[model samples]
Target: MTGIRAALARRWPTIVIFMLLGPVLFMLFDMAFEQMSQDPGLTLARLGNWIAEDVFFVPRFVFMLGALPAAVVGALVAWRDSRGLASGRWIGGLSAGFGIVIGIFFARNLFIFTPPPLGAQLAIGARAFVSVVLAGFLCYGLSRPFARPLLSQEER
Candidate 1:
């Protein structure tokens, strides 16, 4: 508990900044993806509706259940990155965290309101887990270049 607390205390500013910005980024990405994909089927209202219907909806909810684990992973990455000028681990971790953040936000919308058969809940859970893991791995793979420079001692 203390270790996490300390990490939070040290990293809180960065974490909170990213956390708060997450929704804005989400909206931007959502809109951008919609536009780029030219998905006429999606609208802001429909998007909101999907968000409402999916995941475990809580009123006035900001944080999704997956955010907790995601943030932990992100912090770990960021901490590792902080060790040098650029840490791939940090980007990888943060990217994973961001993926989870985005994933949970969407997943919450998907499963939140639907009447569940136990199987459906299990399915959603499995999908959500896969999405989070994939996001992390993708981020890690993509971050190697960016993180490499930072991780190098020359930068320090």
Candidate 2:
């Protein structure tokens, strides 16, 4: 318990920033999913319903969209804290990739109701997991070239 508390105390700023950014991330996910879907109108309507009808849904959605990705970014930031700006850019890209993956899973589950087909569920999970990981790697690869360190040489 003490260990967990200590970690939280050390990392509270990052956690809080992520939590605050949750809504923005959720909106980005919503927009991305909206664009991807065949019917944008229907997507907007469903999103509206979720926001208006269920208070709990938004928080969960935000958590999945925001907190999960933020956690990944935060972990990377902590891991690569002393690293340079290149690392920062990679972190951003990685974070975005993760956010998108988590968003896709949450969005699919939100809209699609799969029947009790164990195999189907397994397949979907596997596919989604693989795709998300691939996307993350892609993001990392693309962003690494552009990344700049977060701190200056003097700081290091």
What does the lDDT come to for candidate 1? 0.48
So what's the TM-score on candidate 2?
A: 0.41
* Candidate 1 minimal-lDDT segment of 10 residues: 142-151
Question: In model 2, what are the clashing residue pairs, if there are any?
Answer: 84-149, 85-148, 85-149, 86-147, 86-148, 86-149
Model 1 regions lying over 4 Å from their true place = 1-14, 21-44, 50-69, 85-115, 134-156
Residue 19, candidate 1: Cα error in Å is 3.3
Alpha carbon lDDT of each predicted model: 0.48, 0.48
Candidate 2, superposed: residue stretches over 4 Å from native: 1-12, 28-50, 55-69, 103-108, 111-156
Give per-residue CA lDDT, model 2, range 1-156, as digits (tens). 565454444444444444455444445444444445445544656766655676556556554655565555544543343233235456556645665566456545654455436554454444444444444444344334223343553387
